[model samples]
Each structure stands twice: as C-alpha cells, then as structure tokens.
Target: MYTQCPDCRTVFSLDASVLAHARGAVICGNCETLFDALDTLAEQLPPEPFRLLPGHTRSEEAPKLEVAIYRPREDVPVAVAEAPAAPAFTPGFVQDRRAARKLPRRWPWVVTCLSLALLLAAQVAWAKRDVLISDPTIGAWLRQACISLGCRLPLVRDVHRLHLVARDVQAHPSVPGALMISATVRNDAPFTQPYPVVSLTLSDADGHRLAMRRLHPSEYLDDAAVLRAGLAPGASAALLIEVADPGNRAVAFEFGFE
Candidate 1:
C-alpha cells in the first residue's frame, strides 16, 4: 500500500503485512504526525429521499437503501494520543498535507557545501597554474601538468579537465578610453590534440549580455598544433596580455583543456 506523508510530502511504500495489519491510526514517518485513516474516507450514506420516518415506511413500496456521498472531515488530528486530548496542530493554522514533513534548515549543510565549493575552487585554482586576468580584458593562457579526477572512467572526458577565467567586457574593442582584448591559448592535454578547442565569452558586471566565441587552435592560437604547444609534462608558457588603454582593461579571458 502507498501512503503519502502529509507532513513531508514523501510517498512511502508500506509492506503488505503492515498495510493489512494497520489499525485505524497511521503515523507519518517524517513528521511523526498521526491520522485516523478510516475517519478521512467518505462512505455512502442514505440518500435524503431514501431515509424515511420510522413510522412512514410503507410495505407496498420497494425497500430503499440510502446512498449519498459526503466530503470527508475538514480537520483531522495531526496526531491524537487520546480521543479527549487536542491534536498537535495549533487551532486556526492552515494545515497542508505536503507540510507533514519538511527539510531541515540545512544551514550546516549549506555552509559545508559552500566551504567545499570554495575548497575545490581553491584547489582547482591552486592546481590551475594559469593566468589571472584582473583587468577588464579577455583571453589568457592556462596550463596544467595533467588533470586527474583521481578515479577512472569509461571515457577520459568523464574526467573533464578545463580552465576558465572571466571579466566584464564589450563586443567591439574600445580605443584610448576604449577597451580591447588580446588572447593566447595553449593546449596541455598530455595527449597531443591535433586541435585544441577554444572559446571565450565577455560579460558585464551583472554577468548579463555579452559576446562569446569558439575557434579551432589555428583560429584561436598563435601556433597551429595546440597539443604540440602542450607543456612537456611539467613545462609552462606565458602569454602576455596588455591593454592598449591600461585604464579600462577589457573584461577577462578564459582558457580550458579537455
């Protein structure tokens, strides 16, 4: 039997024996609320016309049985330890079956998650060994000896190893006071990729609208063989990025290896 936990909105499967043996009351596993399962089901009652006064029944007429539908109870105890005691719910509070169970605030989990994210990001950034674009420009070089997910997978792509950098930028290069971008891409995928995939996106401060591009190594880099540009295991390269107008540097540049 399937029972919905009004408190948590979770559906739990009930064992056949348990369902069969369940008494009038059923308790929610999540919120620990109790309900009278039978009290909530509507049963046919005598119809208005079918119910007659005790003395008014006429033997001449065919015997009638009352059959009517009724809305179940408007309010059922969230829990009822004893018939005379009030339920767990406060009076006048709107009760929602879905509210029977609720997730914990998760403040600790959230903090832990954010902490882990920062830690991983820090680790990635640390292991990054790439360029950091503080100005408003785009395109910079990033290199890693080799990225390992620390585990094995069917495809190497499953262990995605990529580097990314960003900043607020404009589509057309501005001059003097105008902003412009210069990018250099180098591939370090250990395995020589005849072509290294390259892409860049420029956005505003709010991370709203901007421009992006994806080009082949020949299109995105100074050298044709990106994988050849790959550092020999522990090798590194520096791609200089200078703004024409040092003031409003273009947004930022991003690089990745797969």
Candidate 2:
C-alpha cells in the first residue's frame, strides 16, 4: 500500500485523488527529501490527461508503480565491525623477565680474580731486579732472602774487615719493606778494579742471620777513576768505613756485601 520515494528511498502513500496540476512537489517525511511528482509520475504514467475522481480524496494505498534503481560503483556492508579469535598460548611467556627472580643465584668469582691479579703484579715487580734491605732489626730476616740470591758488590777493600754494622729496612708504599744495611768494607785489597765490590757477613749473638748490605765503591763513587784506585800494585790505601742502617734496626745485624 506504500510507494517507495524515487529520490529518498522512503516508503510513502497518497490516497486516490484528482490531480489538477501537472507539476507539484512533495517532501518525504522519513528522509526529509523534496521530489517532483510531475517528472517522476510522467516517467511512470502513459502520457494520460488529468484525472479527476468523484471526490477530492487521496487513496490510502498508492497505485502500482515501476521505478528504476541506481546503484553506486562502490562496495558497502550492513554490519558495523567484527572481532578476531583469541590465541592458544599465553600473552607474554616468551620474553617476560618478571619470573627470573624465581631462579637460583650464582657465585661471583670476580673478587678472588682481582686479588690474584694484584698479587701476581707485585711478584713480577719484585722479581724484575735486586732488592734493597735497609732496616737493622728485621734486616737479619730479609738478609736471608738476599743471601739466598747470592748477590755481591764490587770490592773496594779487603782483609778489609767489617766492624759493628746496623742494617735498616723499609717497605715500599706499594710493596713490602726491605732491609738496607750499611757496614764498613775496609780497603785491604791493595789492587783494585774500576768495578770493585765489598764482601762480608754478620750474625746475631745466637749465630742467627741479621742484616746485610752491599757497598759498590765504584758504583757509588762520583770519581770515574775508582777502578784506578788500584793501590800502585802494592801500596795500601788506608780507608775508614762507617756503619749505619738507612732503614734502622732494633737489635741484631748481618753482614755480606757480595
């Protein structure tokens, strides 16, 4: 009983009635569209004259009509939106770190490694050259290490005996202290070489080793001709030797310049 509007696609109906005018316009209520009844009806009619009914009444039902449909060249769908399905696995099982605390912790060996490295470095430095012992007390102890090394100084004297000598020992800030003993190596060897070294040994009252030091007269001499100190072959150079521990000792003393 309703007629679909040609312009707005709304369903409307006009009762059977006399149409006096050839052209007229009507507004569609559903879509609020204005359309020409004259042109639209002309296409639907067979070019007939104005029709008048017994009374001026509009039909409750619209007469059967034919209309052509116009469609856009695009695609359209009726539903608004769709959702995707959920996955089987958990959301963050592969890359999450929150669960790491549940695992056991491991020991850190880095502290031990650093300590070992420092020890090794110290050993290397000490091993590079000879040692210097300068203390009179502990000098005896460290003298053992020196004697063990068997190092001797250039001889500037001989028969050249050593008297009361004090050995001093001091530790390097970065390294342990050493014993530095200063004793008298009396000049008794009449003949001398430019590279002369002193030789002697000392012990504690209990015959225990005390402190020892080396005295290289040539090495210590600013006089380049110390090697020429060679007593004209036989003439003796009465030399005076003093003893002092540069490192300072408390009790005993050891002597060995070699």
Give lDDT tens digits, candidate 1, residues 1-258.
344544564444554465457764678777888854333322233355532212222266786768867767777665563455655764443454345446456789989999999999878754532232111121112212123334211111211322223333343343445344444333333322233355555455666435555654454447645444443322333332323332323244454443
Task: Tell me each candidate's TM-score.
Answer: 0.25, 0.22
Q: Per-residue lDDT of 1-258 in model 2, one digit per residue for the tens?
A: 223456555444553341234235666777777764433342132233524211224568988857858856765444433544465675585436556666555434666788899999778745532232222343345546556888532223333332323334333334334333333333223233233455434455566555444666564445556544443323333222334433332345444443
Supply candidate 1's per-residue lDDT for 159.
11
Q: Ten consecutive residues with minimal summed lDDT in candidate 1?
A: 134-143
Q: What's the true lDDT of residue 52 in model 1? A: 24
Candidate 2 minimal-lDDT segment of 10 residues: 128-137
How many collisions per candidate?
Answer: 20, 40
lDDT of each: 0.43, 0.43
Best by TM-score: 1
Q: After superposition, how far is residue 258 of candidate 2 from its true place, in Å?
A: 5.3
